[model samples]
Target: MREQQENAAVLRVRGLNVDYQTKKGAAKALKDIDFAIHAGERVGLVGESGCGKSTLLKTIMGVLPKNGDVTSGRIELDGVNLLEVDDETRRKARWAEVAMITQSALNALNPVRRVGDQIIEAVRAHRPIDKQEANALVHRLFEMVGVAPERARDYPHQFSGGMRQRAVIAMALALSPKMIVADEPTTALDVIVQDQIFARLRELQAENQFALILVTHDLALVAENCQRVMVMYAGTLVESGPTEEVIAAPKHPYTIGLINAVSVLGSDKQPISIPGSPPDLMEKIDGCRFAQRCPLATSICKDQMPEAVVIASPGGERMVRCHHWQQAEDFALRASNPDVWQSVSAV
Candidate 1:
């Protein structure tokens, strides 16, 4: 039996379909995506570039570009439908209810303004508080994120890369938001700094009891920081479940391929790359998007899309979008053989 949590979900996304209008008709960026994040729950979204991971985050935050539209979906926060709300209401809810830490601290911060003022501005935008109160809050936030409270007056250029990122995180936490979406929060930083940033994030999440949706290309990072994992491919979610179970025994071919591709320390087995490039979103695919690359794919897989199959596990319920998920044990064994993945293109 699947374990059901008693706590209500903090964020719920159902049947989300996002499209972008292009010169060649419309491109589907997200298709029927659904998930939920409960209070203090950490979920990771992992995929290659152009897999719609970032687009999904932007859509959830209501910051999609002009060309992008949520053709169908429901985004709810604490039972409030965000997409159904008025513009003013959604605008007001942006920082106070849901905030994001973008990929780059250099680009996200304003060059001219002091970091302190920017954070204070964010706090005052939602809260009816004076500069002094906001400033005090900013100091507390800085302390929370491990940045020196005295350095709040410094400009963005004055802080190191990691410290700058902490400042951005401080801004996101100003309103005590129930959920935070971090897109590659530790990108471009050194490995040591990356560990530090995630440590701080884990500490903050524990202290505040806020939900988190972390988007990144690093499967190792997802395994380390998130309790749940969702794997995306060509704008579709292929596998989702508890992090430990999914990482240890992947059901989908794509998920297995991803695990095989990761370089394990001191392991004798060499990393094997998944064959073939991701499908083109502009083209209409009638079958499984990964059919061309999957070693276990058959004629049926090439002719039809697979629906998600739910499997109950001790950790939680596992979801795999592959027709052959029932033979996952066999697939896992075959996927371990580097020879099975030794396509000429992979070399």
Candidate 2:
């Protein structure tokens, strides 16, 4: 465990575990997850579907779905633990301090209300601002996210998918949050629109200097935008470190599998799939959560759970959980085919 004597982190999640009370049993969705994001840092949480990436975001926003529960852990924003706060305080702190931009902007938007009204409502609810000022801010925010200033008056149906996403982002900006939990902020968008949204997000973060947590299944996106990368699998963080370093040399087997799925554009190799599905969380985990899928997993891995280890690398500290991580073959060299990956310089 890393110590935080300075206590200046923008956000900190410690031993966070989420569970669902289903008929089968208490299905653990999140393991003992721990990570911290500093001001102006772009931290990407990358993993496959059903890996608890979105659930983690929902818990952070205090909007856990109907059956979700925080089994144990602490989520702190600016040194204040959100888990301990009362409902009123959580309500006040929710969008004000920690905001989240959900997956679908079109569906997320209110069908009947005008987009401008929605933005105004968000701002007014958080702070005691007058309607006139709120309206002005709404227009400014619309312009900020590259939306047409006049289009703010239109309903959600009037906007395109991209515009709807931008509007949602604009609404999330109403309070000027210190941190943003964006879960697939660019889902289902075409390449051009995705680039536009990401560019706007980067610009806003640069201007406001807020911590950003980008949760997505796309490893390529994470490699491009994030300063640091945290790879999650089966509800646990398997590896985390500088993005380039992790991309170049992943320490964990699951991370290697992720890299295998995407060949670096500059490299000359073919993309390879991991060849297996994620383990079912409903079942009891007797050993490493990834042992079932890890090609390098041995009998020991099948019987014992591995703890996170700070692997030594010239690039950076890549915290990996596989006991045999140091012995695994490097996946970096396999990404020789430009067909599977693109060069960062191209971006």
Candidate 3:
């Protein structure tokens, strides 16, 4: 049965679970995750480290490590099951139908090759274009990414950090993909450069009308750039909704913790760190994955898994996985007080 909506989405992931083999046994990296993005939509995936954000991206890209396996569920691209397709079809789909902009531009690019050559090769790999045509396209791409067209001949080391990232963006755009999954594309860059890179990405995304999935740890960044946001914890999606609604009134305790963890610039209030570490994935979780760290956790939360319920709001409908989401607004209001989290230990 198709779990996707009747209208369909550009990309849909349903009941997806991933595991990685360890010495003891297999560790669950991702739990029954479900989400969909429509054409030209912008969505953000935000979580602390080791919350399966990268695992989800790698699974969708079909680049999971050798030890990792997709245990169950389906990943659909425009209604086609990506997980069920043959290797040949998957190979052709990558970088052509959907593309990725990696986290670190420095490591993603080859130090020895000329940036232009890399871009030209990427274009040729997907399409049978002559060298002259490829070169012209490379020049145009360089221009589009804020790099001087003539400087395409230079090696990656010669370009500044921001310029290198821009070049990577150009390479991702070369195939004119329908969707782009950017995994922390602004990491390691200065504040100014991060702003510039995202600005360019937003402009290009608007111009081309491609769906975008941005994975990051920055809640503020998501609030500013993404139309919708999904929050993950201990390999499970705790909450997701329209950006404004989620940021303003988070329903899940974990979601509320994440919002309170960041403070506005120049604000008198200090950022409140969420206490306790994430649960170990290799071990079995008896109940709610977040019960150990959540301030509002109750006996039921420690004994049974919570189901995701859709709640209606003035803005739109949102999903939250919690037993006590009805008290979310009250808890969210209390979460701002540092004393509320004093009992929990910080990492």
Model 2 per-residue lDDT tens digits across residues 141-242: 999999989998899999999999999999888899998889998977997999989988999999998889999888889877898999999899999999
Off by over 4 Å in 2: 1-6, 263-268, 312-316, 329-347
**CA lDDT, candidate 3, residue 225:** 90
Q: Sort every candidate by lDDT, greatest first.
A: 3, 1, 2
Q: Each candidate's TM vs. the true structure? A: 0.95, 0.91, 0.95
lDDT of 3 by residue, 147-238 (tens): 89999999999999999999999999999988999999998799898998898889998999889999999988898799989999988998
* C-alpha RMSD by candidate, in order: 2.3, 5.5, 2.5
* Candidate 1 structure, TM-score to reference: 0.95
lDDT of 1 by residue, 276-321 (tens): 6898898887778888787777778878889878888888778989
Return the lDDT, model 2, position 71: 89
Note the clash tally of each candidate.
0, 8, 0
Best prediction by lDDT? 3
lDDT of 3: 0.88
Candidate 1 residue 219 Cα shift, in angstroms, is 1.0
